[model samples]
Target chain A: MSIFFSLFAGLGLFFIGIRLVSNNLRQVIGRRLRQLIARAVTGAGSLALFGLLAGAVMQSVNAVIHVLVSLVTAGAMDRKRAFPIIRWANIGTSLLVLVAAIDLHALALCLVGLTGIAYYQQIDQSTRWRHAVGALLGLGLLFLGTDFIKSGAALLRTEPWLRLHISELGLWLLPSFAIGAAVAWVAQSSTTVVVITMSLAAGGLISWNGGTMLVMGAGLGSAVSAWNLAGRLQGSARQLVLFQVLLRLQGLLLTFIFYACNRWLLDDPFNRLLDHFQLGLPARFAAFYMVVQLLSDLGSRTLEKPSLRWLEAWAAPSLQENLSKPHFVHDEALDEAETALLLADKEQQRLLACLPAYLDALRQDAPAALASADKRQAAESQVLQLCEQFLVELADRQRSRDVLERSMVLRDRNRLLGSLQESLAELHQSTRAVMSDPTVAQLLDHLVQSLHIVLETLAETAALAQPDAEELELLRSLTHDRSDLMDSIRRRLQGSDLEPGLRQAVFSATTVFERCVWLARRYVLLLDGPAASPDHPK
Target chain B: MSFEHDINDEQGTRLVSLKGRIDSATASAFEQATQDLFATPNARALLDFSAVDYISSAGLRVVLMAAKRAKQAQGRLLLCGMRQHVREVFEISGFLQIIDSVADRSEGLRQLNA
Candidate 1:
């Protein structure tokens, strides 16, 4: 087959292989992997190393970051801690390209083929084999893309117009860096960008230096994604994002200088030794990129806190958006304290969106989720503060008694929502504590669900006192139904071979739900128009 | 005990009646009783926790799943025949809000029958 045709075939096969691998492996080892990530440290060095490894494994830096971001938001790690992990992720990702550029197609093909068989092997025992295919598919895509760039470059060896585009290497570096950064930001996968650049280099499409420079530029670009995710969180979550941006910016500055000096120092003997002999241009470039990446990643890892503090000093004043004033939620409005408060509320609403999920999560075992439990409480407190702020403003504006009642109901609901998160967190902890007795441990997931259904029902009905007969009927029946579930759990708690911690979490969740119902009950009283809290009668 | 579940999609109700106890051990069976349809009624479901001599979160999970399933379908989950203890379970634990509970199967029959 022609080179282009071969390249296309390889690329297609490669992607298919990776899809199969990721899925199968995810099935086989998803929990172990998630636990490892959840337990990862806050320091940049370790995080970056993990990133690198994940990037290397997936051969997609952007994909790793995306996964990391999702994990972080899901409370696998504090957003504050994701900074260095991202740094190392980049370094690890670059290695894929370096290996590919060396033309290790045979190794790539073998791994992809064996893993592909395991993936499509079609047996219950080999379920994990299916995910192995996802890994290979990624590798295959890497090779196929590389092959395309190489043949394309071989064609370029004869094409003069593109050659005319080459002599301006330094000028090209500037644009390519910007281009790589933009592409990485948009595609959200640094590996893809680097692979493309590597393909161009192996094909002799871009000069050796051009491809290397772009790889470096890709590093700067990958940082933007972490910034966006961190921006998506509340409080420390927001700070974590800014910290990531600072690390990336410093790395970029250093990279830019390195890129600029690379051309001037091309004639240096050490570089000359790297360029000539069996080492080759791309290999030398790879070595240089590796050293530079190690330094920048390590530097960012060490200096992230201090460096971000510096970046914040300069950038905070220039930020224009404020969450407090109700601008769109995605505004660059990072630093304003007033807006930050409002932003926190938006985050709480977002958390509310996760109520069902939280309910599901709580029904399981949660040994690594203590941090998430803490975060849930913090978010609820912030929401309460926001409601209080809004309430104070409403009272000052002379809002009506009915409006005040509505505000109180809303505030109470918000508090209940927060309590639910803690309850769920505790539920998970309890489930783990009692796992030895699967019967009792398994019961906790159910108990939490029973509690959740009630909270949601109240929210749906709004606990209006004079609720229509249908509403009353519905409420009475579901309440009774849930009571059935609770009784069984209590019995199990009383008699089962469960741990003390497990028993306590279940008891606590059961209690919180009951109290929330108490709030909902009073809410019904409020529909009596100030009759709910007679002491503060209108 | 034999259990039969009928889903009235257009009417928005999942009617499940069981001849056995609805306790932790049997809840999974209760849930499987209606696995054929995830969300009840797209708007409402009728659960007969009556044959349920006992109920637990395992049963509540089935209820919550049904509730979530019903809510997503833009319907409602209406449960009935929770014994006094069952009634207390929903009351003290607060599963009532997320699910609509009634006194007996007749109440659900009346609600859905109408």
Candidate 2:
């Protein structure tokens, strides 16, 4: 009971330590991880090498693979680079097995003490130092936990019933293999299973052949674990996990054939080599594990190309893949300031193109109920919000004076357009309530007709390279005339015996109408240059 | 938009208080409510614009139209309690030139009766 308690406590502490280190390290790295991948990794070889280093530093190949998956999803790295990186990350898992084999309690304790003092002193106030300390603490806890697990497991040698059961199971390779695989799956760490198998074999409880079968099962167990995990993932991530499973299966097949053929070989050359070297069973088992890993990685070199092709072909991106990405932002335009400005201008024009459609929606006959009008307004708001997002993204780009000026104009224009649309939507809602008032209804109809004219002129002028002075004058005159028209409507309503609600409806509709013309005039002035602005008053 | 009008005396000096947004939609109501004030006997109109939040060009045009009519009737159109932003709209559109403005109701009445 004590042994079982210690074992579970150790496993719990191990998982917590790993999770703590991974999460904190990710925060410490933050966006620099993407920057590092961009700068340090160029080709497949470098990417693989970097992946190995990242896995070793992070202490979890699975964690490293998840980072790669995120990078791919963010469109920060291509799938081609991710494939090699994933391969090397898988190779890097061997480091954990190697570390677990040797006792690092003393070194881990030293690091813990050093980081503890550093943390106490607040030597570096940055999050980077804090994360480093956390990682050291996690490493120390992992070392301590492993020691507890090993000590607890050592007691199993004294239990005769367990030994008898193990011996009975060890008589058949398949059952022993399955038992090893099952243990690894439960622990979610094949390294733990391999270490236990090595300890059992070295203690003279399990034979060398039984240890080999257990190691073989550990490989399949890892594959099963990855497949179970990858089942929930999509795109390049799922493909990489699938590839990992296939690679493990390949290793399992090779190991099984070697085990079967060794029975007929003279004196079992593998065991003879371990005996001749006077190495312990633990070292011998570790050596076999590494050889299998190396062989699999080497064999997988030829499979990489076809595997990547298959992944790409199978996980063909959907059309909506681009929905999350900015449609107007092209990477090539970012290199040149002028080109970027031009692209932003084009994007602004695209937003303006939506103006006609928005106006058309407003011009349509009133809906049957208030709820439908609200729904239509909500949908229109979302579309306008998307345009605003795009405009904001464009505004964030670095630009020179000319481009900067243009961006400012476009940003202001976008804002005013959004305001105008909001007012129009409000007017539509009020128009519905006041539809029974013939005076209000007629005024709304006339307002809508006038708005259409203003919008068409604005849209046409936006498309021109330079709006002629006469055209600019005409727009300004129309703006003045619209203001007068609204005033006359106000005067007419004031002379009538209309109810307050009907009068208020006409006022709100006229507000949007006058502002639309004002906005058009402002935009025309913006195009005509700062000197022609109404604020300056030509 | 709303209009709260009070007749100060038998001489018919009217105090008209406006609130909320006065744009094209509400301008008609505003004009309708205030148009009759200037027509009253011995009428001197004082409009309070402090609570008004915004005025589009349409609203400014109504103010200008009222000012012109008040002047024609030999009645004063005095605006008081204008919010800074709303006042700026009036100033920018040159509506301040068309109507007399005072700081508050007392000042507006003093100016209108003067």
Candidate 3:
């Protein structure tokens, strides 16, 4: 009972230590880590290497995945580029397992001792080193937990009941494999499960063959955990999760094949290779774990293109995801300020073109192919955010006065576009709210129709490479201040026998419409260039 | 409400007279009624909206589409005889700035001839 208690406590401590290390390390690295990941698009080899380093430093592939998912969601990194990094990160996690195979009692105590000293001196309170201290403490706890589990497992080796149960379970590989998988699925970490199996095998409580099966089971279990975690995710985010699952299955298959070869035709070639190194049971199991991850990585790479196509087809991108991604702007363009500004300008034009889609639901004759207004609005907001980030990044880089001035103009237009989208969205909502009222139905119809027309016109004007003066003048006339017109409508509604709620709805709709027109006019003026923009001076 | 159109040629101009409500149900027929005018390059037409009592956004879209088609074909489209409510729709939409309009048919013909 005491031995079981020690093992349970050690497992709990191990889980907590891994969580603390991953969370604090992420905080310590902060935005710089994300920036590095975002810019690591040079090649697959470099990205894979970076993933390996990230996995080793973070000590958990799950943490690395969370980071990748956010970067992909923010449009900072491409999902295709992230695939290799995810696969390589799996192999990188083996570093901890390998380190655990060796005795680290002294190092673990030293880490804990230093952390205690830091806490006693209030050094852990310092902002600069706080996360670092937390990470070190987590590492110390991790090592201490492993030592406790190992010692507890060794003690359990002498228990008659435990020895009999293990001996019976080891006879049939299925039970051992099932137990390992169940524990790993519950724990949400395959490495943790495999480490426990390694400790058991080293204590002579489980045979080497049973330990290998358990390790393979752990890999499969973690993949299942990943699938559940990604149940709510869609599009490319879901694709990453599928990739993780496929890689784990591949690893499991490869390990099974090797096990079969050794058991049948090959006459234990794998065990012979390990025997040549004279490694202990724990070290051999660690080697087995590394090999499984390596095989998974290598196999997945071989099938990368086909796998990506399948994943994409299975988890097709949503309209919102498609809209959120910037089609014209590339981070690489930031190096050349002029090119960066030009690309951003093109992206902004695309955004302008998307404005009319917000009224799709209100359009009686709207094309069936158009996405819902809600999806369009959400996508537009995301695209706007990405554009803003790109412009900010461009501004930070070294650039000449001319390029800087152009970037500033684009930034100002970007802000106006954001405001225009918000107003239109509000207008759409307000218009929908008043559509059912008999007194305002006709007016609402007219408002929706007219706004749609103006938005379509603005989109057309934006698409032009160099809009003629007539087009500019037309936009100006269309978007001119309509406060008086809105006011007149309000006065007329106020005098009529209408509910106050309906009247307020009309008022809100018209005000938003007026704001939309004004913002559209300002956006067009900016498009005309700073010199021609009277309302927005350079 | 039901809508109908009558088309005829007067010298070099196509004269189309539209009647009744031009809402969603009738906007498509209205568009189909004037498609031939834009099919011919540089075609000139005068659309008389005097008989049309009401026009919705869909109706406005058809009119806007005609105007764009006319411009693309390097032709001219002139609107006249629009009722007060009908004219307000175009005014609020800013279509008046781009599409040529007159108060009556005779003025539309005179402008087209000019």
Candidate 4:
């Protein structure tokens, strides 16, 4: 009963210690972590070292994984570049077990006291220093938790029934492996399981071979937990999680092969080597962890191509899968202002790309073209509405004045596009209505030709990021030309004899055409106007 | 479309009845017939548009041009008997403020002569 109590308390403290340390450390490092990741991609070695350093400070591999996943999702870092960070982070996470193996309770306690004193003196006014104090306290709690786990294992060693149960089942290795995996999965931290394994090994409660098999299972358990944590993610983010699982599986395979070799040989080569270094059970346990990590890293580099091919086969479709779906507004990206803004820009471009096709559909005189135009309008309308909702959510999340202004500008542009679409539909309806009158039909045919030119120019100018001098001049000329032609048609209509309703339909068609030109001009100004200004160059 | 005009002789007042749409198709005809009326020096011309169902920007443009010509000829151009839709067009184009509109031809004649 005492053994169960100690073990439960130890596990509880372990969970709290890890959470406190990682959360506070993350708070201290906040934006700097993102900046470090940005700079870390300069070289493969730097990226690996960055992962190691970050994991060591963050003290939780899951936190490092989240940051890497976010960077990949935001398109800041390629998935290929992100693999090294994940690989090294697993290695960095093993470092805590090594540190905990040593008796650092006294030193950690002293550091905790000093930080507490500093905190009480109000020396930690800045959030960073306060986080530093919290981190030191977490370190103290971790050391204390290690002590409790060691004491708990020692208590369990005295229980004859528990000893018999473990000793009777363990030599097979598979049962121990399964038990270790179950514990690590529940704890969500293989490092904690490893620390517990070390305690049992040091207490002479478990054999070195048994400890190694358990560690292998812990590795697999960490991978499973990582998969669970990233379950909601898709595309490259989920791909990274799969790669992480593959990395752990490789480590398990290496450890299993090494265990098999050691079991086959009468000499017991690995244990003999441990004895040669004058290492104890604790040191050997940590060495096993370090060895598996090194072997996995090597395996990753050698099997990079096949591993990537395999992962790609299992990868989800990218955000650009369907034009009607929301592409740029990823939920994961909303956490970062820059990434969200960039995604919004991409969505705007996607919607703009649909404009030319819609106009072409409108101008087509065939029955099939009209049907296609309706379909295109429906898709474009759905996409535009989704994009508007996305932009509004993005703006609500972001506090920057620049982001707000950009979102507003984008909203305005989208609104204008929507109005233009409505006008085109109205024009289509009125144009057909007046077509039944012979005199008006003749005029409508001439107007359609002129209107097509204006629509073509609008579609062309809208697609450009910035209209050149000639294109701008051409747009102005075309807009002026359409206006003049509409005026002349209006004057001609005044002289022709027609029914009142038919005349009204033609007049409305002309009005709709004028509005279309106005919208086209507004679209040009939105894309190139302020950005091209001297104070805000493109 | 269809347009009907009735010119009534009164002291310093003339009421012309217009029916149907005064749009691009009929604006010129409406202007051509009303041109001589406004050309009468210091004569007040009241255009009753109660029967007119619609008016377009082109019709508004012509009306504005007639107003300017009327003012230049030292005559007044008055509008009356406009339907709701026609009044909305004038209101939307901001022509309502520029052109004088009344409840009926009598009110238009009263304002023009006054």
lDDT of 3 by residue, A352-470 (tens): 88887787776555666366666677788777776787788888785666666777888898898888788777777777766867788777767777887788788888777677886
lDDT of 1 by residue, A63-164 (tens): 454455445533345555665666666677668757854454566667657655665665333544444455555656555454453454345345566556
Candidate 3 vs candidate 4: which has greater lDDT?
3
Q: Going through the candidates in order, what is the number of backbone clashes in each? A: 55, 12, 0, 3
Please identify model 4 stretches exceeding 4 Å from their true place: A1-36, A101-161, A320-351, A354-459, A464-521, A526-538, B1-114
* DockQ of every candidate: 0.12, 0.02, 0.45, 0.02
Summarize candidate 2's per-residue lDDT along A1-538 as a digit string, tens digits.
8888877876677666656664555444533354566667877678878877765544444546665665665545666676677667656766656665556557667866887788789954665577767766776666566556655666755678878877765678888889779866655556667778777776677877778788888888877877776777766667766777767777677776676666575557777777888978878888777766766676567676776677667765432233233446444455565555555555555545545444444443322332343444454444444445444545566544555565567667656666665665666676766655665654565466456545655666666655677556655654553566568768878889988888888877777667766776776676665212233222
Better of 1 and 2 by DockQ: 1
Q: lDDT for every model? A: 0.54, 0.63, 0.79, 0.67
Cα lDDT for residue A17, candidate 3: 71
Query: CA lDDT of B91 in candidate 4?
Result: 45
lDDT: worst 10-residue window of model 3 chain A: A529-538
Tens-place lDDT digits, model 4, residues A1-538: 8877776776677556656665565455533454465666769789878888766654556656766664654334667888888888888878877787445457657866887788788867775588777766766666566556656755655678866766643486888888778766755557767777777776677887678777888888877877886576667777887888788788778777877888785568887888989998977888888887777777777788899898888886453323445666654676875666566656766665555444343332322342344455555565677567667877887887777877787788778877766676667766664565666664454344344545555555655655677556545544542465567757877788877788888888778767877777677667654322233323
When candidate 4 is compared with the true two-chain complex, its DockQ is 0.02
